[model samples]
Target: MTTFTSLPPEITREILQYLPVPTLLAFGLTSKNNHSIQQHSLSSLRLGVFHSRLGGMISLMEATADRSCLHSVQMILPKSECRKKDKVIRNQNLRIANVVEKYTHTLRDLEIACWELQESAAMSLAQLKNLKRLSIRLDHPHTRFSGLDPSFWETAPGSPVWNLFTSKKGEKGKSALGRLQSLNLERAGITDYQLTKILESNPNVRELSLRKCVNLTDKIFKILAEGKVGRKLEVLHFTRCCEVEIDERVLDHIGRLLNLKELSLYGCYRLDSDLVKKLNDEQWHIEDLTLPSTPSSPNQEVQIDPEYK
Candidate 1:
């Protein structure tokens, strides 16, 4: 009978991939060789905390740290067992942020889906300086989001996330937001000032998506179309955002962007068909556009299909 550690490297990797996350961590602790193998073998790690409690989530974070080599992770926040009670969930959110800090060096892509995103998690996200993409979405509990989150980057005065913006060169250097190329915020009620700060912090960003956001007025869109980031933005997508009418003048600036390759306004209530046609004529570089079939009528309350695009 051969011991488990006696297996070849290929065999060991295959085994680790199949084992549950907790079991894999426990196995890694058996020896240094096993630990190294776990690090190299793990590529895509997705954890579902919806089944576990706050304490269990902490244990999971510790276990993941032990295994090592986490490149991409999507953590789903645990659903409320009692619905009304969210104390445990808040704790779990903070713990998840701590886990992110542990993997900050190695992680390139991180996605967090939760009911209510706590400030701790948002702060921790700002600390990451090596990530290429950061996506946060509010799925349950809080549907209408607030951009006050990234505002932490510019506001709060003394918070860590805020400090990172003006921070001098550290282990990661002055580039506080890291190598982030894409930032997607769904249902995040980000204000004009908040979005501007986000762009200011992340100058290298090229792709951006704001979906199901309620407060995205024309001012925000105009900011993106004419701001410094506008020159570099290649993909812009806004779905089911801004119930109020958006001026054609603001959207015209977007149409003139030479770098924009993809543009989608699937469910915007403000854009009429004529204006979209004018944009198509005025813009020479837009290759992908998701516009509504017809212009929205005044006082016409109709359901616009967000998935139409």
Candidate 2:
């Protein structure tokens, strides 16, 4: 029975991988050896926190600064506070921004859930040259504040956060991301213009997930399916994105993406039987296809026979 303290640093680090973020952080504080082990594991760490003790977590995250081991950080806001307005929330965001600014060079994957995204926060994240994956969960103003003025959605283009990734005035086009690969805007109210701008900048993306993004329309999908941007995309997950209706033409355009291997249309009720049949009959190289739970109607049955490519 080897105690954690008795194990070598390499062995200790391997064990740390299986532990939760908080457990690893706690173990790191036990001794200098444990701390070093934890630091090494930080590069592969993926944090998913619905609610955590902010002070302690921040301190731990900061302590691993020199290690520069973080690859992904997923911050899930408390469901109760998702729609509430509070200064503390802003402070917490500032703290996150501070951490990101200090270590953007090492961070690769970032996910944030917030009531609204400020320009400054986007700007801070844009500085991360190694970022490959991003996910943003935004609470719609309409859903959060029923009967709120519609004008609240209208913000000036030059706003600090808005301009963060956008080209600065009087400058040639420059992308904030250099190595981005996958982007997920689940439930985020991103406009077509913004999405195009991002795709144009990160053309090397391979996987794009727009799950539950009600704001996106068919036009956006048209652009994506055409492979005008994200030509290298191989996996597309458009689950529950009811706003974007997929017609046969759109499906045909998607089939043209020769490199696409995985297509997920879970909960997309707009996709009819014809489109499904076309996808099943097409001799494309798609290896995985995900659909929603079926209806009881016999006519709605879609039989996907397994055939190895």
Candidate 3:
């Protein structure tokens, strides 16, 4: 009765390391022996905790609290597109804070797609000094009521989450999350000013995405084209940012990223695809390029080409 799980633990562990999260989880549920393999592999788990199963989140967190190898977590909130009561969202945010506080030291990649962002959750994120990749997708049902005024695209004063990116008065220009290499914020209520500060803090960011952000102008792209930031960025996405007056200057700024491998400007109605075609013709080794389907059509299907000409 020789089986895969019957192999030596060392060999099993080595094989399990190559398996992705879903496969590993499935293997665990197959048999007691496989479950044992999964338990040991929790140290290097890339976990995804769904909103429907949040009641078990604490149990899962408690189980892995002692393991120093927890590397990534993706938290998806329930009813992300609909309105939720303030109290319920706050409580859920507290749970998020708990998860952040628990894995602060070991977590390197974290993604949270929720309806709202709260101060406690923001404050907890500030503690993850080792975090390398972070994605926050906030699909707020009511931006104005939540203190995110769309007209200004401003995170009001005392907003703890946005504040985390700001340098402390005495830090001599050090950013709170200085170790971030990849940062993605979708539909976030942030302005050019706050985003500039965030970019200034994380000088090593290679992948930057600001999708569907309402308040941005072309100024942010201009900053990205400058000095160290432009030189280091490998991926840049500014999709569906309707307000931005993206013209030749912004395209030129994006073109200056010498190391850029991926660029997405989908849903940018103002950007001329001919300019993108010109940039593509220049050929700077971009592996992924997504452009608007039409010159002024927001709903047009995006044209994605790895070797776009």
lDDT of 3 by residue, 1-309 (tens): 889757899888777766766687799899998787765553343333334445235424433123344444555445562244565457667767876676566556676645457777777776677778787755433333343345433332224368666664346656677788988886776787788888787788998988777677888888888857778998888878777476556877776788888898887877778768667877555788887556545777877997977
Runs with alpha carbons beyond 4 Å of true place in candidate 2? 1-89, 139-163, 166-172, 228-230, 292-309
- Per-residue lDDT tens digits for candidate 2, residues 198-287, read 787778888888765665666776788665553567888877666535544456666666787787877677677555755656665578
lDDT string, candidate 1, 87-186, tens digits:
6447656766777665555456666655446666666667677777766654332122232244332221222333433333354445356477887766
Q: Give candidate 3 regions above 4 Å deviation.
A: 1-84, 140-160, 168-174, 283-285, 295-309
Any runs in candidate 1 off by more than 4 Å, and if so which?
Answer: 1-27, 32-48, 51-85, 140-175, 293-309
lDDT, model 1, position 290: 82
C-alpha lDDT of candidate 2 relative to the true structure: 0.59
Better of 2 and 3 by TM-score: 3
TM-score of 1: 0.65
Provide TM-scores for the models. Answer: 0.65, 0.63, 0.65
lDDT of each: 0.61, 0.59, 0.67
| Candidate 2: 10-residue stretch with minimal lDDT | 59-68
